[model samples]
Target: MSSRFKMSDLGLLCFYLGIEVQQGHDGIKLLQSAYARKILERAGMGSCNPCHTPMEHRLKLSKASTTAPVDATKYRGLVGCLRYLVHTRPNISFAIGYVSRFMEQPIVEHLNAVKRILRYIAGTLDYGCHYKHGG
Candidate 1:
């Protein structure tokens, strides 16, 4: 492939984009712990207490929420970062999607929901996808 394309041989993949890679005799693993941490720190929740779940049960969010509005730009940024984190953290995908609906006019309630996701990530940052080697 190098003969056909101009690309530098960076050696075995360790990190690409925001995902971390680990290769071993058993298999390969894809992780985004660092990226996740960055998101939490950027949102000023780096030291937030961890939660067992990303969201509360029976969570009901709406475009016409009655709560006061928060900074749309900041809310969007957090939701966007959380979305990218879904690549290796499917567990939080649904919660992120739920909160994303209010990106245009996020309220304190919506932001609180996003915070829960960050807390959950803090507790499970090491979680990731693993691919086993075939026999």
Candidate 2:
């Protein structure tokens, strides 16, 4: 397209929408360390220590138990935002999908679960999907 029309070369892509894009010898890697940090700071949990896992495997979420309700819009928004992230973040897909099931009427417990995910992100800022060049 650049040959057809007059356009400036921008060089290699580095960042887009807070996501870091880097080309390596093997392939290209997509990461969102900046976005993860912003999420921690926005939630005022930046100082909180990181955890190995987002949530325990035994953590069970049931619709029967109605713990105090929180902001539906905010919770849903978070879930929706995370969904976009799952494109290059398959590791968190299971957890995020589980929590998203209750977006319509999220409770305090559900909110806490979401916070845990943020905490997990803090620890795994370097985590991302890597695609090989020849793959």
Q: Which candidate has the highest lDDT of all?
A: 1
Give the poorly placed runs of model 2, Cα more than 4 Å off: none
Q: What is each predicted model's overall lDDT from 0 to 1?
A: 0.92, 0.83
lDDT of 2 at 111: 88
Give the alpha carbon lDDT tens digit for every residue of 1-135 in model 1. 989999997789999998999999999999999999899899998998999999999998887867899999999998999999999988888999899888888899999999989999999999998999995
Model 2: per-residue Cα lDDT over 14-45, one tens digit each: 99876799887999999987777766776777
Pairs with backbone N, CA or C atoms under 3 Å apart (clashes), candidate 1: none
Give the poorly placed runs of model 1, Cα more than 4 Å off.
1-8
lDDT of 1 at 81: 92
Q: Give, for candidate 2, the lowest lDDT window spanning 10 residues.
A: 34-43
